[model samples]
Target: MDIKLWQAIIYIVLALIIGAAAGFFIARAWFKNYLKKNPPVNERMIREMMRQMGRTPSEKQVRQVMSSMNQVK
Candidate 1:
């Protein structure tokens, strides 16, 4: 291919890559902020349970609940 064609292709590919990267980062940041502001109610329930029980819930318990919830789909 000619140099101009190759340059145009490369520029298009670079622009796409940069746009995708910017979108991913922006989404990640936004979701993180959203989660912080509104945490999952189930997780909050678990935290409260741990406080009442005077012990932290095991990782297994948390994972089990999360997996079960996911499996409901």
Candidate 2:
């Protein structure tokens, strides 16, 4: 019946959406945990460098330092 077919389609769509959302959340959590385990050393170095530079470090600067640090081997 047409009604049954539509119901099946709706269920499939809902399942796909739920699966995608769950995948995104899992990936985000895993990445956050990985970063916590591997602390950003470059950012720490940059902060020390900034202190030596006698300049007030901003949040943006700290992020930049972390980004650059992530690029290192």
Question: Per-residue lDDT tens digits of candidate 2, residues 1-68?
Answer: 99999999999999999999999999999999999998656666777889999987988989987776
TM-score per candidate, chains pooled? 0.57, 0.56
Q: Which ten residues in a row have the lowest lDDT in candidate 2?
A: 39-48
Q: Which stretches of candidate 2 lie over 4 Å from their true place?
A: 43-73
Highest-lDDT candidate:
2
RMSD of each: 6.6, 7.7
Name the lDDT value of residue 57 in candidate 2: 93
Compared with the true structure, all predictions reach lDDT values of 0.85, 0.87
Inter-residue clash pairs, candidate 2: none
lDDT of 1 at 18: 100
